[model samples]
Target: MRSLLARLSLLLVAALVAGCGADASSAEFNGVRLEQPYGVPDVPLTDTSGASYSLKEDREDALTIVFFGYTHCPDYCPLVMGSLSAAMNHLSEEDRERVNVTFVTTDPARDDEQALRDYLDGYGSEFVGLTGDLERVVELAEPLHIYVADGAELPSGGRDLGGHTTATLAIGEEDEAVALWKQDTSALEYAEDIHALLADD
Candidate 1:
């Protein structure tokens, strides 16, 4: 699983690097603005309320930022969420209203509705959380180039850390992903890029 995560991370880095050249001329974001924007994944999943939710059909904001991760992830997940939270803090009330953030769990077995809800509330009440069948989660992540896989089991009768891509995606008004941020991107950079995207929108 570690090897798979490493390989996926490398592939994501390469993809971002390639995307940089594709949109460099009209660069308007701190994050990589894709030349060929991705269409939002339309797969079905359950929201924190245990109700049906579809990313493509249910979004109500002009911009939606999505991240795939699990609550048990010891490092990257929390760091990215914290950065996003800080970025949200940097936005004006009106600007914040125009944006939506969604966290999709890669390990649904351990990330039930209540767990997801509790975890996300610490970040922001408005942040959405999605979890369901693992296969469905993988299907939802496929088009976005985010990988997800199970890991080995631990001695404590539990599973080891799972494999998943750490990149965060920014979907625009037309349900196309306009930009992506790497794990290391700072909160201020996200704030600036988000403000620019909103201005352009």
Candidate 2:
């Protein structure tokens, strides 16, 4: 688990290090910019509401920020979600309405529909939760540079999590990935970045 966290840490630092000059004219937050745009895969999955939906079908007007994590994560998952919750609150009512935060679990075996609903409600009802084929989930996240690491379950029952990346991917109005926010990034910075995206298009 520590190794997984370390991997995410290094990737984020690398991203922050790269593309620093690319968005200097307008970027309000320090996040890695992909060399090429990545579109959300049309992978089929079930939302918390049990309806059929795909990331590709989410709103085009809204800046969709997707996090690939599990509900059972002892620390990182909740922390990132909390940051998003606070960040969402900071947006103006108009901008907030244009932001959609979706949580897609890397551990579909455990994050059942009821569990997802309960877990996401802690952040906000507006947050969407999706749980389905782990492989499909991986396919959806791989291009964005997010992958899951499933550690062995402890004797007590909960499994250790391992994921290659721990960044919230912000999809732009063009439906292409624009930024990657590390898990520990401040809520205020997230709010600012979201606003910046809205201002751009």
Candidate 3:
């Protein structure tokens, strides 16, 4: 009886270990899957200060979040930025330092150098606002799967425009977009995702 009990106990222990390993491999939070391998493309952009920035160069040993929206976006732009700010507030100083948040305006005409700078100033200094030549902007937007339609006919004097998608991308250290968080997602959720990426070895 003792020998049989010992064998059963070992089997139970092995089963528990296997289950724990599976759970860890399938780690997820708030319905967001935490395991995926992807990357962001290398694109050249001009910052609000007219300085050139390449996605490959700007990427360091941290996670970078990129959002494509114009300054004139009445609802989405500010809301997303605000949520991002809130999410940053929840992170530790080290994690915050390991994260780069960029706001790229699709409307280069109105969101000129100074205009882009001023708009991002309302957020945080760490937040970078990038806008460059229209042609370059279109080229950069293509690979990201973002489509911006010229909406010069809406409220507020027909300055309204829409994009193909309202999504923010999370780029890992290798310049690859690891995950995409939609505009409707909460800041806390965004923070969690960033934390997960940071924790990944």
Candidate 4:
């Protein structure tokens, strides 16, 4: 009887552990609802080359990924963009052609047309960098819930500012945000999510 009781207790503990693991895996963003999703809207903005391109103009049948950060960001910006580039590398050539990635500079003061162009050029030619009028930048960021505030000053006596979140906005074929992947996620996972989205009818 004691042996049977011990076996039952072990089963209960295993079930509890499995339940906890599932909860952690599916954890949602704090204070951010998954229900009322907001995507990057179609707006006119100047790319790094000073050429104007609408969000609608850049989008295609596949998923579009958008990141918001400044050139001056020391760590997070580069890391996130690197992960995105890695994710793109994992894609097949046909899939690569479908996906479009845009880097939007929240710190327009330091990231003017020329600066923005130079920064993203190192990453990949396919990666487009965009910066423009401050008011227009805010208008584009508000819907995605991206928060940009002025940061500390640099040693060069220049005022340096940065954005808060490391969120990637994933837009579907309809030009609406279908999913938001956070910083903790891996490039492989992001690529998988994009593949799933593309496969869907």
lDDT by residue (18-116, candidate 3, tens digit) is: 999988865564324425645455678888778888776865648888888888888888888998889999889999988978888777878888988
Error of 4 at 111 (Å): 1.4
RMSD of each: 11.6, 11.2, 6.0, 4.5
- Pairs of residues at least 3 apart in sequence or in different chains that clash in candidate 4: 151-161
Candidate 3 overall lDDT versus native: 0.75
Highest TM-score among the candidates is held by which one? Answer: 1
Worst 10 residues of 4 by lDDT: 25-34
- Pairs clashing within candidate 2: 149-162
- TM-score, predicted candidate 1 vs. hidden true structure: 0.80
Best by lDDT: 1
Return the number of clashes found in candidate 4.
Answer: 1
Model 2 Cα displacement at 29 (Å)? 2.3
Error of 3 at 71 (Å): 0.7
lDDT per residue as tens, model 2, 1-201: 999999999999888867675567445455666668787777878898898777787554568888887887888888999999999999999998888899988878888788999999999998889988767776777776675544454343433444447888988767688888888888998888888878877
Off by over 4 Å in 2: 1-27, 149-163
lDDT of 1 by residue, 79-116 (tens): 99999999999999999999989999877888899999
Q: How many backbone clashes can be found in candidate 3? A: 5
Model 4 misplaced stretches (Cα beyond 4 Å):
1-34, 149-163
Decreasing lDDT order of the candidates: 1, 2, 3, 4
- On lDDT, the stronger of 1 and 2 is 1
lDDT of 1 at 29: 69
